[model samples]
Target: MDNYKFILSGGGTGGHIYPAIAIANELKKRYPNAEFLFVGAKDRMEMEKVPEAGYKIEGLWITGLQRKLTLKNLMFPFKLISSLLRARKIVSQFKPNAVIGTGGFASGPLLKIASGRKVPCLLQEQNSYAGVTNKLLKDAVAKICVAYDGMEKFFPAHKIVKTGNPVREDLIALTGNKKEALSFFELQENKQTLVVLGGSLGARRINKLIEKKIGFFKEAGLQIIWQCGKLYFEEYKKYNSDTVKVMAFINKMNYAYASADVIISRAGAGSVSELSIVGKPVVFIPSPNVAEDHQTKNAMALVNNNAAILVKEKDLDADFDTVFSGLIASKEKQEEISKNIKNMALPNATKDIVDQIEILLKK
Candidate 1:
């Protein structure tokens, strides 16, 4: 049909937000005139991220309940009721052909109402361990697109499809541009480069580990492009010298991936998926604060196959230096890790996820 309508909900972190946008972009490519609406938590990153991706977004008065007994937790019931009501209103007004959820606080209410209305619904779960929101909506959604195997435990076996996680197309395309990449980063071709990512807000422990290794890295003739993240830029910005490039953010990840010989990063699903395509020897330090410790679970999928390394935050003090040093010094180890991780990449994940959506629409 020339005019198709779809409602998608996912937000909070870039992990949840980027996948939803990627799916939308794919759908738009197939049905150029399709109308897409994104529902996200008001003031969450998706509110801005979705629109920036050129899709219309509606925000719900929703927030995830905290683990601690706080005022926000007390208001959880009221917020849920309000969000459900708002979701119902949006579903009725939009009359979408189908609804999609990528797993976040806002998606819970949106998918629940859409499913209750007998609208076709789909979910894309990026993690090895399912999120609570996705688990709750398992029975309601018509399809579950997953990145890892053995998700049948959390989702209906018949409904689950292993489509992998959608990643930025641009980053994936830059895999072969080594010379161009090094030029963009202003680095010489002879020196091995180490790329560090601590997310947009920075990882406290990763930052400290990098700081401690500053002299070691320079002495070893390794160039550094450290994304210190916005939160800690003030404290770490002074490390920006000829050998060390400390950035608050790196908007051009394609260049970063192209230039890197080795990478150190948090084990978030989005980071893992992107790194798979980048195919460099990566050291993953999974954050302990995430729900169900999913970051480590995400990293283990790579480590189990010898695709990458996992250095738990708790063990970083004792293990980071040793693990990082070993990976850097051994050319064979770097090449082997790079080759394995690249094999795990699903470069067409964005397209594959939209393929599922199209199938659901036809059904």
Candidate 2:
């Protein structure tokens, strides 16, 4: 077998895809000749995103089972059987030295099959609370790389590796020159900057709350950089003003993180990782729609430590303005949150994860 022939599996959202890509990138740097393949759900974002990152990907006819009674749940058994068979075929063909899962619907089947074949496999759980897929495959995986603590409540203690989530390298080393970031966004440097992000697909509640309080932001002397996400961009783009910049996506995320004095964001694991490194005071509005309410758990991990503020999605309309205005008014609180969160940043997470991967592969 080759020293490093790796297969990565993850998808459904950028939260899963980006970390899979980050791990792939780190593996490539360490073993230049390493061959990498990605397995993702057929219609998910990773099919397109993996290729864009210069990796080959195979699609499996797999999806998450619905929570309630639906036609999709009726087909769950058939889909699971088909995905297992397909995943086995991919593993048999690739003959990988190791397989890595970043936690998504696709990763569940792919890693399960790989483990069944006696192949070394690792699973990265990005949330404070484990998803059903990861939990189901917990015993099969050789290692469980996790971002949050107290996860021993779910996985085998020996297999757990407490590596913080991997973030984009460019964002990790962000040198936030307020003047430069403001200039790039074409905003005046005199005003305090507030950056709002609602993940890649956008949050409906967050979008509505922002719309209702656009006047409040302007009144607070805050310049805004809002990423409305692709789904709502068309409808919300019209709200863009001289003081507020609206985008479907922001490619230069480093600048966005650097420019802002305060941030309002969803508390996904990837967002938390980036925010920790950026060291900015943030208000985390965890999406209630996510599986197991893990986003709230992620936010609470920081909030309990005084590293961030958590505002529930349901409370955004009523409490967002009051909570946000309080932070903007108090410089002391902002500085304290920023310093505490930065202390929690794991800057060498990629290196740490890669190190563990290499050790497992060697065995």
Candidate 3:
């Protein structure tokens, strides 16, 4: 426990990277003197986001292979080899007590090298469906932390721990701030509110749906806070008004959740976890473009429990009006979803994940 060193790797998307950061922050609090190094894909968002979070991060020459045939697919082997070699060098020089992965391309090489070097390795798999890199490295890791149940289907039962995904701190503290949140968003308490989230980069389908039906929502007396994402803000910003607020991002996500009576969001693991804690009725629009279409799987876990509703991107045209109008009109359905989703929330997920990692350090 004396001046312990730890290496944590996760990247490519905020879903993976934020969990790694949450874990790192928790570990730093517990082990005040511990050293940390983060490894992320070279051109991925994590390289910028990690340093902004105040941690030293090294980049690996890694990228996921394209599903369709392309020139990038041809460079896959070279990238993999270079990444593995770089990963080995980093692990060997740092000589960390523990290595943790939150599931992205860089984690594949880093954790593989760490496990081979006999360093204790831990994994946090956020999705209901496992990523390819997580599945490939499953057997070698010391402990596997997960957000959902039935993950034994993907990893060894003995090593799997049901610790929910780590969410942003503000969103976790949202339950009590409803009045303040309503004021923050400048919405009326008497009106129903629907919050749309597609993450910062945006979801093309969700944005399109909002554009098509903004008037319908306003006419129905629903106050809307739409985070159309950074990529789509310019195109959709013209829709913003007193009743409808549109932005590239919502810096105060806690307020957004508090102001929301019903939320319409993409079913990424992090968003699902946040929605659960907020304990509000949610409609999940899972992105089909994600690897293995795991977003749908993430949404289904809640749907099966009657905790949330899922509207596939392809089915939005036929299903959105019925599904949305029904939810907005029924107070009973909203309460039922709220109660069920609260039951599924793992509020202490960050603490629980770190508890497992600490145990790994002892072994």
- By lDDT, the best candidate is 3
TM-score of 2: 0.96
Clashing pairs in 3: none
Candidate 2 lDDT over residue span 203-258, tens digit each? 88889988988998889999899999999999999988889999999988888987
Shift of residue 346 alpha carbon in model 2, Å: 1.4
Listed in order, each prediction's TM-score against the native is 0.97, 0.96, 0.97
**Candidate 3 lDDT, tens digit per residue, 247-268?**
8999888788878899999999
Off by over 4 Å in 3: none
Please report how far candidate 2 places residue 340 from its true position, in Å. 0.8
Model 2 residue 27 CA deviation in Å: 0.5
What is every candidate's alpha-carbon RMSD to the true fold?
A: 1.2, 1.5, 1.2
> How many Å off is the CA of 73 in candidate 3?
2.3
Task: Please write out the lDDT profile of model 1 over residues 236-355, one tens digit for every residue.
Answer: 999988778999999988888878899999999999998998889999988999999999999999999999999987887777778888888899999999999999998888888888
**Candidate 2 ranges with C-alpha deviation above 4 Å:** 1-3
Global CA lDDT computed for model 1: 0.91
For model 3, what is the C-alpha lDDT against the true structure?
0.92
How close to the true structure is residue 198 of candidate 2, measured as C-alpha lDDT? 87
* C-alpha lDDT values of all predictions: 0.91, 0.91, 0.92
